[model samples]
Target: DTAVSQTPKYLVTQMGNDKSIKCEQNLGHDTMYWYKQDSKKFLKIMFSYNNKELIINETVPNRFSPKSPDKAHLNLHINSLELGDSAVYFCASSQAVQSTDTQYFGPGTRLTVL
Candidate 1:
C-alpha cells in the first residue's frame, strides 16, 4: 500500500481554470508538504502543514492555497491557474517538520495548461 497518495495524477486544462488536488497519508505523519516542480526540473516547497497549521513559503503566489483538515490530509487549491503553474505537484509527508527528518513523496500530479 502507498504511504502517501494524491488524487487526479494528471490534470489538463486551459489557463484561468481552477483546480483542487487532494492528498492523504497513512503513515501517521504530523507534517505534510506541497512541492512544485517546474518544466526546468526545479523543485521548490510551496506550503507545509503541521497538525493542521499552515506554513507557506514566501515565494509561493497568493493564488495557491493549502488546507489541512486534519493531521492525515492536506489539500491544495489553485485559483486562476496560469501557464507558469503548469508543473508536477508532489505531496510529501514526514514524521515531523524537523530539518533532519526524511520526507516520503507521492507519485506526483502533473498539470498541463494550454
Candidate 2:
C-alpha cells in the first residue's frame, strides 16, 4: 500500500532509447508534479498538473513530457533519451501551493546510461 509508486525504480539503458515512467498517487490529491534532481542535489520542478490540467511547465527538454490522466496519476515519457537525462526522477503531489502544502514524493526512479 504505497501512496505513490513509479514503475521501474531503476532504469538502465543506452543513448537514443525511449522510455516512460508511470506514476500514481492514492492520496486523493489535486495536483501532481514531476521533478528532477541532479547530481548537484538541485531539485528542479519539471512539470505540474492540477486535476488533469497543466498548471506549471518549467523549461525542460522537448524529449520529456508529462501526462496526467486524472488527479491521482501523472506519467512521464522520455523520447530519444540522452546521457544527460540520467538523473533521479521523482513524482510528487500536493493540494495546492497556496495552501503551503508540502508535496509527497516517490522513492525516485534512477535512470542510468552506459
Candidate 3:
C-alpha cells in the first residue's frame, strides 16, 4: 500500500486557469506539507499543516492556497495560474514536526501551463 498518493499526477492548462490538486496520506502522520520544485530542480516548501492548521511559507504567492481537510489530507488550489507556477508539486507527511523525523513524500504532480 502506498503511504502517500497524489491524484492527477500530471496537469496541463493554459495561463490564468484555476486548478486544484489533491493529496492523501495513510501513515497516521500529524504534520503534512506541500512543496514546489521549480524547473531548475530547487524544491521549496509552500505550505505546512499540523493537525489541519495552516502554516503558510513567506515566499509563496497569495494566488496559491493550501487546505487541509484533515490530518491525513492536503489540497492545493491555485488561482490565475501563471507560467511561473509550472512545477512539480510534492506532498509529504511526517509523524511530527521534528528535526529528525523522516518525511514520506508523494509521487508528485507536474503542472504545466501553456
State each model's CA lDDT, in order: 0.91, 0.90, 0.91
For candidate 1, the clash count comes to 0
TM-score of each: 0.95, 0.94, 0.95
lDDT of 1 at 78: 94
Candidate 3 deviation (Cα RMSD): 1.0
What ranges in model 1 sit over 4 Å off? none
Over all chains combined, what TM-score does candidate 3 have? 0.95
Candidate 1 weakest ten by summed lDDT: 53-62
Q: How far is candidate 2 from the true structure (C-alpha RMSD, Å)?
A: 1.1
TM-score, candidate number 1: 0.95
Evaluated against the true structure, the overall lDDT of model 2 is 0.90
lDDT of 3 by residue, 22-113 (tens): 99999999989999997788879988888998755658889998888889999999999999888899999999887688999999999999
Model 3 misses residue 54 by how many Å? 1.6
Candidate 3, after superposition: displacement of residue 10 in Å? Answer: 0.3
lDDT of 1 by residue, 1-114 (tens): 999999999999999999999999999999999999877788789998889988656488889988899999999999999998889999999999898999999999998988
